[model samples]
Target: MTFWALIILTALVTAVFLGFSLLRGRDTREPAAAYDLRVYREQLAGVDKDLARGVIGEADAERVRTEISRRILAADAQMQAQTAQAGPPVWVTITGIALVGAFLVGGAAWMYNLMGAAGLPDQPLSLRLEQAEILRAERPNQAEAEAAATPAPLPELDESYASLLNQLRETVAARPDDLQGHILLAQHEANAGNFPAAYKAQQRVIELSGDQVPADAYSHLAEMMILSARGYVSPEAEEALRQALQRDPRHGPALYYLGQMMVQVGRPDIGYRIWTDALRNAPAGAPWADAILAQLDELAFRAGVFNAPEIPAPAISGPSQDDIDAAAALPPEERQEMIRGMVNQLSDRLATEGGAPEDWARLIAALGVLGEGQRAIDIKNEAMEVFAGNAEALEIIDAAAYQAGIAQ
Candidate 1:
């Protein structure tokens, strides 16, 4: 009400100012004829003074006086004619003011009606955040999301491929304990656009693996669930994502989905941070990298990051060519010492500042190669803890552990 009142007052004041100007008219400048008459009178006075001082001859003064008198009479006549002319009618002036007032106030009201949110109260940041929390809490569940989804039609399948897929599905259903079969069924079902079947097979795969299940398996389940729901990240899907992250914190797919879920729940600030980290650590050609890149700018804008940093190139973390060359130049005895020194440096760095999974894997492999089996095992144990939920990183470290004879 206060806002509307201020607008109305402003419009009225503007209209009144304009209307007063119209009534007063714009005839403030001196009339040309009146100016000419004043100049002529001044010239007559100057001529009389010049004659009184004997600066001009009688004949010259008399002639100047006559010319000045003639100009005065002509100017006076012109002034009288100008004064006789009338201005616009009083009614016209009043009507014009009324039209101006109507245009100002009516146009303002019309424009506001078209574009403004009528009667909507101000939404401060705190209120907005509270509303977002409520929205997040009330969002649809997995079943609801799936029910509401309109999945695209599956593409036509070739007869032989369809027959093989059917056989695989039947084999998996019969041999419930076959982890390999479940894995294959999950992959094939997902490819066939049967996300429900795909997620069921993936669940079976995870169940069969028991404590040995990798993050990818859970991430895959989440992906299938989201797909089945036409991209809605339901509670079930989020749980799958949580499981994946619990196994592998650096899991790209899980991180991407988690960021998406944050955005869905009105937390673009959290989403932007998650995506930035995911993109920073992501490998070349990672599937999630492209998706993150696509929406990151808009996400940053929503998160109030006006000047978001550029996406950095993937860091190349490994021994440099110079280090390799330096090691090669040393004799066998000295090379052993050099290798030990390098290993010690890496170990110290990992302990103090930490490093990527690749660095941990490399250290484990180096220890194994040095015939330090106990130390290699110890390092593998530490790497497992550091990489806890990250399946891909654990895989790399586990491979090194296997090569080192620290694991079967």
Candidate 2:
């Protein structure tokens, strides 16, 4: 009620001001003939003054007087003509001003009705920001809940696999101190979709390895727990992931799983950042790279960060002669690490962000040069999917793969 009253008051004020301006303007317009007559009388007075001062001869004074008289006659004739044609009726002038006032008020109201939320309360900036934060907090959990509601189809394993699993379990139990036996049991159980068993086996492996256990062991243990829980990041799993990260901050599986936990906990932005960095540092054929790429777009959307362009892979001109010469200045081991880092960067960029044909070709060639023929082949296949409709890109990538001896 108060809001509507304020709008009404404002409109009434505007209309009143406009009406007063229109009426004042109407009263201010004098007849053109009256104005001309006043101007002619002033000229006649000026001519008389000149004559009295003797500044002009009598002839010149007479000429000026004649012109002024003619102008006065013209003004009198015009005024008489104007009087003959009746002026606008007072009613008509009042009606026109009223119409203009109505238009000013009605048009404003009409436009507001069309474009504004007339009955809605104003949304101040602070309230709007708070609402947006709430939405962000809820969106990730909503996505996770939807995913969890749909149960995955059961795996079809052969009886031979079950027999193999039993044999592995027995072997690991018989040789409890054999770390390799525990590792094999964990891997086979995980592969066979027996995640609980895999988790126990991985735990045993961690125990046997003691402090010498690598970060990846904890990461794998965490993963089996998540898989057993159907993707739930239980507190124990979170602890294991945290421990893995503590041992190796860049452990790919740990980073990827931690990102999933972050997303499930309603922190998609943090999840995206962690996954993206992990993808950037991941090796060419790493599973973490694939996992991150698969979810990158969806995570970005959930975080309200859509429209991030797929950065084209860096153009693939290899090292120049100067670059080769510069590398020679470094020690051999450092040079090898530098080359490996550059290759990993290129591979990660293409895998996560995609790139042009030249970039894919360059990456394939570089992998081959580093004696990673299998990775080059896998990248070529993936690039083929990315460039499915572009014959030119397919040809370039194919030719590069052939040159690298991985085309088949």
Candidate 3:
């Protein structure tokens, strides 16, 4: 009400001022014909003076005087005509002022209605935050989200693969305590888009692992639950993520899902920070890297980060299969020497400028293959320190360490 009152009041004041201006009588500017007449009369006087001074010949002076006289007569007639004319009627001025006032107020309201939320109440920052919190707290849970989700079409399976999958499921069902059977069931179920079944099998796997469960177990559980809910991160999924992060603080899947949950809860600022950090430390072809890159721009915009830093592409490192094949063709001693030289070059580069997790893993594996167990252990420890806050990198390093038979 106050907003409308102010707008109407301003328009009325403007209109009233313009009305007074219009009613203030005729214009005071001198008519053009009147000024012209005065100038012609002055010219006639100048011609007479010139004739008396004998500055011009009598014939020329006479011609100038006659011309000036003719102009003076024409100007006098025009001045009289202008004086006889009347200003517009009072009603016409009043109608014009009314039209201008209507346009000012009406046009403004119309334009605003088109461009703005016309009747919506003002939503200040604090109020909006409160509303968001309420929404987050009241949002649907896992089962409810899943029930509301549209079911995706399952992929068609080959006959032999389907038969094997059925046999595996039956075997897992018959032997609930079989850890490997449950793991295979979970993997196959997830591949078949049967997230509910996959997560159930994963839950059994986690149970079978007892206290020795790894972070990836919980991360996989959360991933399945989220997929079951059609990408909605429910409270159940969040709890699973929490467990994953508790086991490994920098777990990639958990962090990715947590960022997604933050966005769903109207906290894109936190989401943006989490995703950017995750992407920065992520290795090439990490599952979540592509997903993060796809939505990063919109997330940054929502987080009010207009000039967000450019996202770095995931680094590809390590020797290619071609390098291995080329080295394989050499004699034993030559091959060993060539491998040593390559390892030294990689080590020097890594020492001068750090490389990706893949590079560190490759170095560790190469040292292990070269029977340099102690060197592999040292490189693994250094890689751990370098990627202390990155769980995915640590996992890669750990796998390489295990292959090198140096895992602690």
Candidate 4:
């Protein structure tokens, strides 16, 4: 009954719209035919007024009046000719409107009957849900299926690193309750590009930490899962990301990955919103910030949003490899001072400009190589805090710290 009522109402509205349009088309106001004659008549009055005021002599006024009068006669004749040929016959208009109305109403009804379920009953919510369930069951998750069919390859490892990994696994097996050990193992495995092992290690980290686990731990687990699957966000990975965000609402990596997941699931608008906010809040030159900025224009276009947030990143300057090489030729004392100076410059820039994960790693390594182990440890702690939820970056920086002998 409601459907029929809607159809009837739509028909009435369409009819009213057509009626109003037709009435407007039949406007009675004639076009301006003797416009030039009226203009000339006004000018003639102005000329008379000017003559009474002695603005022009009578002879000049007479000449202007004659020219104006001739123009007026020509315009009047044109007006009469236009009036004779003015409007289409009223019957033709009525016939055309009838045909148009018939096409609009009859064509719409015909199309509905032919293509739509015109006679069928309305689908209820429960029926729609059942249909959706069937469709979903019939369709497998393409990303998961594809990933399962073709697993991602692990990076090749050197003998020493592989031996170290074996030893680490044995240690974890020996002392399964060591939360820090599990965290370290996860970071090492991730740095080695063994994401499946990294995922399992991070799971162990979560289990060891229990309810007190940090947001980055969960985010790290999610990252490992995604990496393991070659960037597919599986259901388990999605849940991990949710847990990360629940722990820390502004978790940058979680937001970045969630935006990616949203785009994969065909919600580019949501993805664009998530990424835009992430970009705004992300540290300048941070890996995620760079990634977000690089893809933002395409995302905005895809999402049909005209305005994406424009955040400016400050310029960052650091010592080049050539500078370091050149400094090696100086005397020991000069070299120490020069390296210290360079490190200080980098540290100051990062403190003010907000640099990338690699920059932080570089600073940490420089400090450690300079025999400032305590400083390296402090910077590592700060980098971990700042780059929370950025598992890839943290893993890389952790490796740099290990190389620099930043305390276990």
Candidate 5:
């Protein structure tokens, strides 16, 4: 045990040994009291002899005898008093008792030492936990201890990068200024082969575009961040797409998505309408007009919208082309007003004499490429005429449109 305890034990053991050795030599004999009577009688005989010799007068002799008797009694009384007076002080009595206890404890410990010692070695934590689990599995009757044995089940972790990216995209869209959302979206997108989108997202994060600050945020600048989120696509991400469509009904990407969902769920009307709307809003003479026209033509062919001949795409830089860029180069507020004016004028033309869906699609794609997302979206319906029930065309259109936003 402890040092002091060992010392105390040793001292006690020694004391006990010494006590046994000393006490054994002194006492295995009878007490001397049995032979003491003879000596007493002989002394009495001497006193009588002295009396008969008349060493003193009768009165003196009597007085002497009385004095001797008194002395004997006094001696006995003195012995008793000395015995009483020999009592130990409180400290001495307490110390003696303690010493006796120590000796007993020490002696026992020493005896135990002669017997032998037993012990075990430390084990790994995993092994220990495994053992505990085995014990619990073996006997589950102990209530309080059962909790330790039966820990809560571990929750499954999600690791889907595509799904995570979509979630981050939707979150940032809704919140507009959340750095974490931006970072997460950017990282996941990069992992999914959308490096450009990833860079855009990081830009927003680094800029700290919003007021909120999320703790434990790491910079999204490497392959590791993107890879970490990689896994199977998630339902949440799909739902996010749905939510996006709700906010902007003819959101071109969503328009493109309608056909895919319709096939799976057995409904294409909603999707057709969505694409139609996108085409309605698209530009008349922009370069993307032909592709938009083909998609709508094919979709209409499938859905029986019409058997109209495929409209051709006009040249990129045309004779009728206005100085759209010069006007757009103005301050955003001014450019927006100009776009609005252009939309009004276009709306008047369309109301008077309908434009081709290809025209609408081209117009929309051009505006999107120009970074006037709002202006293009404003005519999504007319743009949608290019791909009424077309999933393929819409898909390409959707990517371009969304990319425009992402890159910006």
Candidate 6:
């Protein structure tokens, strides 16, 4: 990462290349191990001389020479096979090498220029962290410590966020045709947990997109829908997500948030299905993938589906079944049944309490896990009815449910 460090790394790598070159230069040649025909001729001459002096018969001498030559040819063929050159490079490999070199040099120079712009001397991680801790201690209370423990709650950003929202609104009010202004205002509202205002902005954007070339408008609205869904899943948010996917089904944010919204509206089965679908849609190593995986893990654990039916037990090298008469008498199937019963009690105990939102979401998720999709839809409709009075919340749930393909 540092210049000196990179220099050392490069030198070490170059040395490695040199070492490999040396190894390759070694006489993999098999030492011309096959005796030369000329040498064989010399041996034959010596043999003839020995025959003349009564050391060996002609038959034995010829047999010895022939055997040596045969072995030599076989060994030579094997040695040649070992030293043969591999085929030409693949296009992909060549392209990868080119990309790597370009990025390495370009990234280093770009990084150096950018860091120079920073201008400030960097502090060590420990010193920086210590300073942070001291500054935190200097504050009136343990707000910093609590924030570190959880996701720091949305900052007390009301004034600043409100100004940004108002500015965006005024821009929209003046132009009315400013789709971007509406999108920005909606995003700001969602950030401030004002789902109603955000939904309204997004709805207007959708209408605008219908009348003109949206150019990523659906995706823009979907992001706000997702943000709003996190705090409240209502019809408006759901519809927003539907519009997003109708435009681009693989819109990553919409896929993930819609998956979550499905869980909130008493359609866990549909939620689980949607979430699993999202896992395929999202890029690897992203937060959406992680969230889906975590949800899947918890769901599987809860449903008593974590164990594999065909898992092989580790083998005991020195096994003797003679000692455990009672245990050995039990059938494997019956033993597994007992284990399931024991695990059920433990799982129930672990099912303590999550907040109401989590509970509703989990219920929806469970339906998905159980593969009872129709049941999940029925649940959504029921919840939708109950949520009707809360227009903003109902709007999100309805939108989520609709996008999830659950019946209203």
Candidate 6 lDDT tens digits, 52-97 = 8988888987887687677656666765666543433355445655
- Mind giving the per-residue lDDT tens digits that candidate 2 earns over 1-408? 666667767877887787677667667767788889999999899988988998998999999899889989989998887744345666776787778767866777787788877788888867865664675454433225435544445577667556655766786788888776777677767767778778999999899887897787899899988887788776678889999999999898899888998787667878888888887677544646676777889999987786433322333333322222333333455435544655787777766776667778877776665667898898898889999999988998999898677978
Model 5 stretches astray by more than 4 angstroms = 1-238, 284-292, 307-408
Question: For model 4, how does the per-residue alpha-carbon lDDT over 1-408 read when each residue is reduced to its tens digit?
Answer: 565557656875786688667666667545464567778999999999999999999999999999999998888887777745356677876786677677766776677777878668878867855664564344334356445746667678767657656766787778888765676578668867878788898998789786898788899899888877777666678789999999998888899888887776666778899998887787655556666777889989988887877776533536543345434443466456646866898999888877777788878877765778988999899899999999998997898799678757
Instruction: Point out the higher-scoring one by TM-score: 4 or 6.
Output: 4
Q: Which stretches of candidate 2 lie over 4 Å from their true place?
A: 1-153, 174-177, 304-408
Model 3: CA > 4 A from native: 1-107, 314-408
TM-score order of candidates, best first? 3, 1, 4, 2, 6, 5
Q: How close is every model to the real structure, measured as TM-score?
A: 0.55, 0.45, 0.58, 0.50, 0.23, 0.32
Q: Could you tell which candidate, 1 or 4, scores higher by lDDT?
A: 1
lDDT for each residue of candidate 3 in 206-282, tens digit (9 for 90 to 100)? 99999998888899899999999889999888999999999988787788999999999988988999888877677
Error of 4 at 73 (Å): 12
Residue 377, model 4: Cα distance from true site in angstroms: 13
List clashing residue pairs in candidate 3.
none
* lDDT of every model, 2 decimals: 0.80, 0.74, 0.80, 0.75, 0.48, 0.51
Quick one: ranking by lDDT, best first? Answer: 3, 1, 4, 2, 6, 5
In order of listing, the candidates' clash counts read 6, 0, 0, 0, 27, 23
Every candidate's CA RMSD: 14.4, 12.8, 12.5, 13.1, 31.0, 25.2
Local error of candidate 2 at residue 400 (angstroms): 24
lDDT of 5 by residue, 1-408 (tens): 464466566777676676555444344433343234345446556777877897656776667667666655655565555432224454664565567767677666676576634233446767755664564344322233323333333333335434444555676799767654565566445545554466466556646844342211222222222222241112322343454455555444434444333322323344355556656654444443444455666566555567334434533421111224333443465445534544455556655655644434445554654566777676564445656687765555455455445322
The reply for model 1, stretches above 4 Å from the true place, is 1-114, 119-121, 308-408
Best by TM-score: 3
Q: For model 3, where is the 10-residue window of minimal lDDT?
A: 320-329
True-vs-predicted CA distance for residue 11, candidate 5, Å? 99
